[model samples]
Target: MNTIKVFIVRENDGSYSSYMDEQANLPYGLVGEGATVAEAMDEWNRAYNDMKNLFEEEGKEFVEAQFSFAYDVPSFLLYYAGKLTFAGLSKLTGISAAQLSQYANGYRNPSPKTTQKIQNALHAFGNELSQLQLV
Candidate 1:
């Protein structure tokens, strides 16, 4: 099965949006909006299911693909804020807590390099946790 990339972003009003890029080259566009990430993702899945049903009813070909959801920098930071404090994340990523807070609040956007650094830090932390053994 093919994989479709879905991007999740936080809007200025503190709402969330999930959408597929135009470059997906699909027959139709998919989008969902909600007040939170989980709600947005649920709506996005509903959109896909609705489209699938429409194609089936019209006897059209429905593309079968999996979705890979990715969060933008601000969305990621905001979503994980509860589980990871800015001070903790600052230590993990070697970035200042204030700067991270600014990114989370949408006051500033991170450069591509800084974004990669954040991703790398999170992935490394995940890897370290995965290697843990509890007795």
Candidate 2:
């Protein structure tokens, strides 16, 4: 199955958006925007299905793909805020909670180096969770 990469980003107005970059190279562009991540994703999925139906009606070949959603730093932070507190994330990434909060609130953008730091930390945490066993 073909996998399409979809990026979810937080807009300056605190809304969310889901979109495919040009690199996806699809015949049509797909985009969705909403006040939250879930809504944006739902709209994006609906857009895809609507496009597929249009293609069928036009007798055109529609490419079937599974979408892999990736989140921008702010979006990721905001989306997971309830589960992962800034203080906890700070410990994992060795960054201050205030700095993390600034990033999450879109008051500041992380440097590439800092972004990588966060990514590596999260991946390591996920690896740890993957190794867990039940009693």
Candidate 3:
């Protein structure tokens, strides 16, 4: 079954805001901000539909894999894959090793192009792993 979640963040300054969206399964969008939690959920639903339609039109899988944006899965996968070191990724991405470290630490999300490179890196690494397994 597909599921969605809402989390609340209270800024240190005393403002309260809420974010609502489906996580890994969201093909449409990750929505943030709602006057109330209900409002946010409503917005997320609409945005999700819009995203789904757009991706569908483009013939792309908007939600091909459940990407856990705030997680260590990416880091662990890259480390265990032995395909790209932080330094290697930095060179490949033209993003410094520090930036790559930040990415691995879940401190930031990569820009679209960088994210594409990360995905591409994972794909290539997986292909290599498969070949090695057969050997």
Candidate 4:
């Protein structure tokens, strides 16, 4: 499976758009846009397959590959806000709810330290959950 790194950008219209950061010699200008990150990812996958098929039909080398998506902070927040609210994330991250809300809304960017803090907290939580056993 070949993985493409996606860079998510928040648009002014409150939609998320993604582009392939490393095309690995593939054609240029592969982009996806939607109201949510998941939608944008689905769009990107469709576009990628369409392009790959076109190359194969044209007698060009088309390698079948599976893609895994990656999300940026704002996009992640927006996409998972239904599952985890800003307040919930703040509790886990030790970041203030107000700040988390700002980050979720694309009004502010988190510093590298803050980003690391959030990632670490999420990892810790995921580790704890992995150890759970049903009664």
TM-score of 4: 0.79
Which parts of model 2 have CA positions greater than 4 angstroms off? none
* Root-mean-square deviation (CA) per prediction: 1.4, 1.9, 12.3, 2.5
Sort order, lDDT high to low? 2, 1, 4, 3
User: Which regions of candidate 3 deviate over 4 angstroms?
Assistant: 1-84, 91-94, 105-108, 133-135
| Shift in Å, residue 89, candidate 1 | 0.7
lDDT of 2 by residue, 36-112 (tens): 88899999999999999999999999998889998878889998999999999999999999999999988999999
Candidate 2 vs. true structure, TM-score: 0.86
- The local distance difference test score of each candidate is 0.92, 0.92, 0.54, 0.79
Better of 3 and 4 by lDDT: 4
Indicate the residue-level lDDT of 77 in model 2: 95
Q: Supply the TM-score for candidate 1.
A: 0.92
Q: Could you tell me how far off, in angstroms, the CA of residue 43 lies in candidate 1 after the best superposition?
A: 1.1
> Any residue pairs clashing in model 2, and if so which?
none
**Clashing pairs for predicted structure model 4, backbone only:** none
Question: lDDT score of model 4?
Answer: 0.79
Order the candidates by TM-score, highest first.
1, 2, 4, 3
What lDDT tens digits, residue by residue, belong to model 1 across residues 2-111? 68899999888889999986678788779999999999999998999999999999999998878899999988998888999999999999999999999998789999
Query: In TM-score terms, which candidate is top?
Result: 1
